[model samples]
Target: MQALYDVPAPAKLNLFLHVVGKRPDGYHLLQSIFTLIDWADTLHFERRGDGRLARHDGADAMAELPEDDLCLRAARLLRTESGDAALGANIHLEKRLPAGAGMGGGSSDAASTLLALNRLWGLNWPLARLLPLGLKLGADVPFFLGGRNAFVEGIGEILHPVDLPAQTYFVLKPPTSIATQEIFSSPLLARSKSVAIVAGFPAHNSSDDKNESLQSTGAEVVKLDAQGVAKLCGGFGSNDLQKPAEAICPEVRQALQLLEARYGNSRMTGSGSAVFARVSSEEKDGMSNQSMATMLQDLPGAWTGKICRGLDRHPLSGWA
Candidate 1:
């Protein structure tokens, strides 16, 4: 293919993020479950026979982005590893997901870049070969490349396939961006002591005492209905980083309050500056698109919000 148009890099929500431990190298060991969302950034790629890689992104977004962003870094790394100096591409990114919202926008884009370039350059690399290169780009990169919901651990390198029923969410991004370091370095960060069991879960609600009785029974995936989703997620832990994120960025707290007031519950996903609430099937059916749009229009300038649905896998899952 001469071009890959409208390639999507979907954002991820950490349904539950727990800081389990710390490595001697200073990287915090974490355990979380990541699920893809319908809200995503779109990328367009065209073969560049000139051997010059170029990324055309929104000027304002570029100003906010690091000089050597993940997209460029991914492209360079893939090309170098391919041992094909002549391979190049022109990448255009339509930045839809807000930056620093803890939604994995940049990492998803980088994953998409590697997948698109693999085909553009005729490398046809398998997922196994591409995964290590993805890790070098960012901790979240490999999860995106994994192409489905995952139980993530070990600084984001360990991943196990997870299955989540399709569900709706209301995600709100505040006007400000949060630097990840600010959240991690804070002394107020909390770590969870209890480990979450994801190997098996009930498909239906159980008695109070029976809830959260999960085990490693090799029953990972299940066919669940809308009501089953709540019981399944209730067993998962909370985002430990949320405490520090709210402290480091008051906007994170503000976003949480806003979502909670409307949706009845809200939690910070991943880190800070963005909060989300689960929308029940009845709530989603009653909500109209115009209402969702009006809510977003009411936000401050450059702030974004979306009524998104959880995805079964990345839109570009088959690309790699």
Candidate 2:
């Protein structure tokens, strides 16, 4: 195929994040469940025979992006790593997910770029082969490359696949963006000493038998089925970064308050500036899209909000 059109780069939510420990290298050790969502960025690719890589803003959403955007960087990295200088592509990104919202947008786009180019360039590299290159781009890149809901650890290089139930969420993004580096470096940021056990979380202990197993194993078991997973997530865990994010940006707190007022429970996803609340099945079943929109009619015009459904796997999960 000479082109790949309407390729999806899905976003992710850290259902729960914990700063279990800090590495000697200054990287923080974490435990989080990374779940894919319906919200995504669209990408289109056309093969170039001249081996010249180029990028364009398909939707004008990426007009300000630099030449070193993750998508382009991924392309260059793959080309160099594969030693295929003759392979080239014209990439157009339809940016949808907001940048710096801790939604894993850039990382997802980079992962999708790698996956698409793997096909368009005829390299056919497996996910395993591309993983190290992806890690070089960002910590979240490897999770997106994995294409499944995962229990992530060790500065995000380690991943253990976990099945999650299909569910809906209301994700709200405020006008302001929080710099991840700023949040990480903040003196006010909480360095949580309490390590989280997978079984101690709601989604991880959905069944009595599973709870029994966890108790017997001292919460060492780490895998769960889809139903159990669905029961486990959806505003289930805390984000250790939320306090610092709010301290840096009041908009983050505003978004959380708004979502919490409606949904009763809300938490910041990833780092900051974006907050989400789980829409219970009973509520989702009773409300239509129009009704849902009406409920959120009072949201600030400057803010962006969407009702998103969680995905079991990445759209391009099998592509690699």
Candidate 3:
């Protein structure tokens, strides 16, 4: 193999996702602040001189079932654009992020594939040129190319960069899977939302504000060692589908209740099932990580939960 590609595809959280309306094409228009998280899946690619694409061992087993799998689809799309009929490669995907948790794992995987193959197949296109191709794969794919904290609007293709204070978060998920399309298509889905096309970015508390005002509002909130950063549960934000999701999936509700009761601030991440809470970094000074783990262990139920910190930014780059 003459060319090699390795990429990290990261997960995302909709800090505050709102449903403004629905498009005539059945796509829901949304406004959200998308923060990239550290959790991710990684994929590696290698080019074969012959015009034959193969998947390695277990990777082929996963790909054999779907011609339209995001990774394969991205490869084909990149090839079509480059007109490289003889271009072929082997892709190895290391799946880590949980699928259908509204974390954009598959979309990130697709974005990585498109970017990696553009180089491995010898297509020298800039990230901007590849974005539209990524959009064809999924709306969230383009955001991965932007690779920063973004204020996303439109059908989620529009992007504006924003600066958000980072903190540690405890992410929790119940044993339930949600179909994004199903949630978007239900009659119960809310569509009558006012458009939020502000001229400038939303304001966040700066360091001075964090010390004086942000910490005064709640007891559970804690300021980080850095200036103007608060680590707490509960946010000044919400997700659009949370109510509808709770109605359809009870496990999601149970997970939220459990998280909120222990930590006092918990909300769903993307669509459903996966919910998270803000944990004070300073809380460790008073208690240990093992104590927190024991807190969740004592909870009555069967669900998957983890204590992970929020990301200062997305984990990968197209050029990296």
lDDT, model 2, position 215: 13
Which candidate leads in TM-score? Answer: 1
Candidates' lDDT values, in order?
A: 0.80, 0.80, 0.70
Backbone clashes under 3 angstroms, per model: 0, 1, 1
Q: Model 3, 1-320: lDDT tens per residue?
A: 36554578888777667787777987877777677777778888888666656555363252342676888888878887887689878888888777768888888988888777777776768988988998899988888877776768777788777555656666777778888877776677777654443335433212232221222221222113333223212443357788788888888898888878866767887786688776665664566778877877865575666666556556555363
Candidate 3 stretches greater than 4 Å from native: 1-6, 57-65, 197-199, 202-237, 284-287, 292-302, 318-320
Q: lDDT tens digits, residues 1-320, model 1?
A: 78989999999998778786777888887877788999999999888777778788765332223547888889889999988888878788999888888999999999999999998788999999999999998899999999998778788988777777789988988878878888888888865344555546432211344323334334555344555455434444578888888877787888888877887778788776788888888888888888888888887777678888899988878777
What does the lDDT read for residue 112 in candidate 3? 81
The sequence of per-residue lDDT tens digits that candidate 2 reaches over residues 10-71 is 99988778776777888887777788999999999999887678788766432334657899
RMSD of 1: 4.5
How far in Å is the alpha carbon of 219 misplaced in model 3? 33
Candidate 3, backbone clash total: 1
Alpha-carbon TM-score of each model against the true structure: 0.88, 0.88, 0.82
What shift in Å separates residue 19 of candidate 2 from its native position after superposition? 1.1
What is the TM-score ranking, best to worst?
1, 2, 3
Task: Provide the lDDT at 250 for model 1.
Answer: 81
Error of 1 at 233 (Å): 5.9
Worst 10 residues of 1 by lDDT: 202-211
lDDT of 2 at 11: 92
